[model samples]
Target: MNKIAIVYGSSTGATEAVAEKLQSALGDADLFNAESVNIDDLKPYDFLIFGASTTGIGDLQDDWEMLLPKMEKMDFSGKKVALFSLGDSASFSTSFAGAMYHLYKALKGKVEIVGSVSADGYNFDESDAIVDGHFVGLALDEDNEYNETDKRIAVWVENLKQYLN
Candidate 1:
């Protein structure tokens, strides 16, 4: 029984969609809306998948903002964790990928870094996703610009699945 948690902060449902897809790929997973998540709930899961959307100039979306302060104060100790971020590269100069920065910083020592999903080509760190350069679900609008970036997200989740199994 590989218990995993998929927690996410999404404004327009984009990030949530990605999170759900990741969950499907990874097998059975507990899903949480960031606003309702308590850090204490993490106790049961062996692995965690944190998802967030970019908002207001590279800042984490509102839901994640509420959870971050609390999550930062807690300890993940023996947890295995990964991150996935959703954002439009054009809107924020720093981009949606920046959302993973803080969470990774806070949970670094407490958990093992398994993977990360970033539109701007983030190194997956301790995982094979980086070595394979596996990126799918990269959605784009009619103009060929990243309006959604879904393919890249799918690849990101699939890569993270490697860690879960």
Candidate 2:
């Protein structure tokens, strides 16, 4: 079985671009769009990578909002999930990458979620995405910190290798 699956919802293509980059960096993972994915299609994968973008006051990207309800019904027992989020921290400082929180909330106990990052090095004021002292997952602020996206992805992917392998 292909152990890794990347499921993402991107309305403006920015998140899709990152998802694509992640797939390339990881070297072995399948990509699926939230708009077209169903639970059966995801059943074979042991690890899932979710890419969600924050939009309109920290709302999940349109496609993800539609997918969450269905996800609640799927069996995540024993599976692993990671998340990557896109948000403009300068504009939504109060809720930067807040979409990651929603994703984490949905899958918290159901799956062995990995890839939490320290809350330091980011300039945002607050984010529900932070749980205990770290962001729920990889948080990318390409709008203001475009230069760091690649490095962040590389580091996050390196960390995830321990789990995926």
lDDT of each: 0.62, 0.90
Clashes of each: 9, 0
Candidate 1: stretches off by over 4 Å: 117-154
1-165, model 2: which lDDT tens digit per residue? 338999999988889899999999999889999999987999999899998999878778889999988988798876889988999999999989999888999888888889999877889998888999999999998789989999999999999988876
Clashes in predicted model 2: 0
Expressed as tens digits, the lDDT of each residue in 31-124 for candidate 1 is: 9999798889988888887877766665667988888888766767667887766655444434434565556666667668776333354322
Question: Worst 10-residue stretch by lDDT in candidate 2?
Answer: 1-10
Between which residue pairs do clashes occur in model 1?
136-151, 136-152, 137-150, 137-151, 137-152, 138-151, 138-152, 139-149, 139-150
| Clashing pairs for predicted structure model 2, backbone only | none
The lDDT, on a scale of 0 to 1, for candidate 2 is: 0.90
